[model samples]
Target: MSTQTPTVRGDAYLIVDDHALIREGIVRVFSDTRPQARLFEACNLQQAIQTLQGEHGPSIDTVLLDLNLPDSRGLETLQRIKAVAPDIVVGVVSGTDDDHLAMQCLQQGAAAFVPKHGELDQFVQGISAMACGGIYFPRELLWQVTGRLSAADAPPMVPGVASVRLTQRQGEVLRLLLKGLSNQVISNELGISPETVKLHVSALLRAHKVSSRVHLILACASPHAA
Candidate 1:
């Protein structure tokens, strides 16, 4: 466990899980760390979507979603949530600790992927990191996910990173992307169109030799990467 207490942002958060106990536990975790944060709950995907679409939706800045809800399962749950609320920061909490699944969730716009493996501290820290405008995943699992990419196909390493240059706009896009912001959010922040953001993202992927945003993030975090 970290010796220093993480600084959690006071943002409105939503917990989406069918299990009442699970939802309450997560709420308690957040409350312990961020007592000022406004929190809400939903038992399934439909309720979650409705909550996001509700009048109070605009105030919601973050969400902790369970993949095994009664109405939704696997990556589909995440997909639906992102489709409705692209700008909201989502942290996926699942019983399965599959690194590939975590990667998929990140590719699909999740800010964090935390496995519900009985580590309350890890969950709290992950949510804290995301709340503070950063991405989070278990370090071991993240390395494992990066290891799946072979050297030949991996993104540019720190040694050769100088060779891969990016435009000013692409650099701006990459910075926001690393913060787990969606294309729309980045576009808004940078005063660019979403289509323009997509072009810059494509350019960034090519420059980094990465296929997806998740891969790009992991590559940048790797010790061997720039």
Candidate 2:
């Protein structure tokens, strides 16, 4: 068999999950679609931390975070990673279909939210959109959040929000980032390359005029807060 060469790109990504199979599957997908994308793997939070905190740490552009790891659990997992690296984009993944909890994550700081059972195409679309300066959210959840806002009540522009005009996809990515998923997870869940996720994140930062992911999360989560 012929050997496959890795793609070279400006972006780099990390995958943090406990399952070897899942990690392998994700790597394969990225390798196939984004040959230039570089991928890193961590079996647990500690390993993830080591890779992220190393001398070459700045090269990482995005992360794929799992909620249930051997060393971390629940939202704490997301919180800790954000604390460690505020600039890197993150996407959250879980086995259960818990939209409310997922929304809570968005409110906190995840780039995207995806269920394990979601269709592969939807997942890929979500990741691709996020990579291309867009966002992705579950259709049901998007409706749930925006359904209460009347068209008249909705402004031509969201008040006091002049920096970034959120494309639907960017909004989706912002929502999930607030929720705390890592870039690799977002890529796998959305079936896209991690580098794409990084592109959207950079666009988001520029649009928001925010210096870091922490500020982006705060702005998105506390729209009413002064």
Candidate 3:
């Protein structure tokens, strides 16, 4: 059976990578399949931020971000980008084969992870997957990062006092909170008021027995907690 190609909108894409060839290759692929996909190029994080913040007002539907850049390193780059544009769908493109880093990127709101060493087919597939509302993680790396599990596998939540338990709404807030989304972003994402997001955040902190959002994220990502 033939696979369906994603129809990316004409004016929504940003590519942030230091290497010229990689950027060119990505542009070529998109140009071939998604001729309507408008492309913006950035050699570094600062430039990427400028492109996003430029009078267009977050028109970017997807971003292909390189983890290693002259100005930023490791996960810090991802964090900075997300901080600037929490609503933009980000995909981490990296040279390293670090599965753990890829998993962390996913946890931090990246829509996909693509390795530089992977085949062009895989990269194209990843982009298509992201464009179609699916996350793309390398098949080989998934088990190493998320750990092996069967269909029946389920992790237990921590037992605690009833007051400390999170309500369904509060739990949704906590999920976004763990992604380091701000109150305004969370409010918009959840379709709730900023004040309500703030209240839910406060409630989440109290329930998780944590004093700060950083602590809450650490708690939520902890293996023991899940």
Highest TM-score: give the candidate number: 1
Task: Tell me the TM-score of model 2.
Answer: 0.62
RMSD of each: 9.8, 8.0, 9.8
lDDT of 1 by residue, 140-209 (tens): 6655434433254444333237676555566667766765566777888999998999998888788778
Superior candidate under TM-score, 1 versus 3: 1
lDDT of each: 0.73, 0.65, 0.68
> How does model 1 fare in lDDT?
0.73
Clashing pairs in 1: none
With candidate 2 superimposed using the best TM-score fit, by how many Å does residue 154's alpha carbon deviate from the native? 9.5
Per-candidate count of clashing residue pairs (backbone under 3 Å): 0, 39, 0
Candidate ranking (TM-score, best to worst): 1, 2, 3
Writing each residue's lDDT as its tens digit, candidate 2 over 1-226 gives: 1122333324677778898876776666666657666678888889888877874467777877888899999989888898999867787766655867777777668877656556877666555544443445666655444442224444323224654365655655655554445666767666768898788778777776676665564454453622
Best by lDDT: 1
Once all C-alphas are superposed, what RMSD does model 2 give against the true structure?
8.0
RMSD, candidate 1, Å: 9.8
User: What TM-score should be assigned to candidate 3?
Assistant: 0.59
| lDDT value, candidate 2, whole model | 0.65
